[model samples]
Target: MPTKSTRVPTHASTPVKRRPGGRSARVQDAVYSAVGKLMATQRPDQITVPMVAELADVNPTSVYRRWGDIDALLEEVAVAAFTREDEVLPDTGSLEGDLREWARVITDDIVRPHRTRYLRAMVNARDGVVLDACPCWTARREQLAEMISRAHTRGERTPSVEQVLDHVIAPLYHHVVFALPADTAYAERLVDDVLSMRSAESR
Candidate 1:
């Protein structure tokens, strides 16, 4: 087994340019970047389109017209941010290793710049909207599909998406959402417990 590396990854993800429609793409990038800058120091609720626009050097009308409101902008930015994060999830040989490594990386992300804004976006996501509406959720599923497929290649079965989320991912998110102090050790324990339960259930 490959021992876990102690290297802490910097969570400063580059903002993706969303919306590929020419000037629209530029506008989206500027808006997303503006929101990211604000989110670094202020909660999403504490930010306004005017504030974002002033920081982005765009017209407030453009911000309002494109995103409609601060809530939508934050959501979009959150999804974009998560996409960047997910792009780095490693493909370790074992499903357990893959998840444990993923969890450890995100455990460090809990303290990154603008971490609170993204966590609030994720926790508040399912309150009134479809959880799948968030691009981050979709990105995670797609990544899992690939991960699971790799496990199958090694003749190993993997947990269902729901199981993975409920047992592993959700618990880590809880730490962030609740502002609890947890490190990757918490992630390893959570994964170990969940895998143990799954093994017991299978027997």
Candidate 2:
């Protein structure tokens, strides 16, 4: 835990150590990795620079000089976690099939103890603003929308792909992330509901 005297670094003060040489970006990545591991177990409020430094096996001064404070460090950590390879979007031919795959992929991640803990923390802290701000959100949503568009190209549904994404799949996913029971069957049911909605809309 940071002491009162340990000032939280301003967002501006938390300069990313990215330089033209790439040396600083590497260092910044290491720090963010350490913080991600910590976030798996601890809430953002409990994360500290010393703990991150210890995990990265770098001196505390290096952490401070690079990231400035724990909050900035935490933000970077969240960003890195979001961009990790496990979250990459997959392509399948059909909208329903793709959505089922997406639901499975998403739930598999959310059901993990580490990720669920972090997600629960974010949800409890406030509506999923932290997750929403992640760059991956836009990227993943776009990919999903593209999948939905492919369904439209096939004449699979009446509502536009964007409507399905915004109304059905997105809301279901949000519930899965923030509120729904994290069961495989439950996830499948959500996918079913989205597909049913699409079919009805088409009718």
Candidate 3:
């Protein structure tokens, strides 16, 4: 439960190095770093390959060669941000505890800062031709589904796993990240309410 001041790292972009694996890896790193920094200030729609190339000090043609288009570049940035191993929920042998930790992690990591940026990125992707093509949404949906499945296995949730996924967890994430209220006490209350519902169903 870190305060807002202490929560976000000053440098939000976790830049990966140009891997020596090959030229493609290096070029991709350049593209991701460039897009990530730009995303910090501007919405995803504002990011273009030329803008990224200028920021990364690479040729716009080079950026296009690696990523094809702005949508592709933004997709890569979303995958890197959302699908990282650290973003996955821990099993923790108890659904309630695991979900509590999950909520807290998301609250601090994704919701603390740049909430609008992340939400706008999703919106932009959805309104474009690259909706299903984005791996970020796919991975996150799978992760959420898996968490619900684990709760079902433990007999910790009711009204079907799909119900909880749709009505409970999904809505909570939407509320916390997209419609971020200035008052986080409400966020905590939502988390607690979800956890309590699962606990009650378990018994």
Query: What C-alpha RMSD separates each model from the true structure?
Result: 6.9, 8.4, 7.2
lDDT tens digits by residue: candidate 1, 7-34:
1123333433232657766676677777
Name the top lDDT candidate. 1
Clash list (residue pairs), candidate 2: none
Model 3 bad stretches (over 4 Å): 1-20, 128-134, 141-161, 176-179, 182-188, 191-203
State which candidate has the highest TM-score.
1
Ranking 2 against 3 by TM-score, winner: 3
Cα displacement (angstroms), candidate 3, residue 161, comes to: 4.6
Q: All models: lDDT?
A: 0.68, 0.57, 0.57
Clashing pairs in 1: none
lDDT tens string, model 2, 34-137? Answer: 76577667876687788889897878998898668666655544434333333445567677777777767666766676665555444444533544343435
Deviation in Å, model 3, residue 91 alpha carbon: 4.0
Which has the better TM-score: candidate 1, or candidate 2? 1
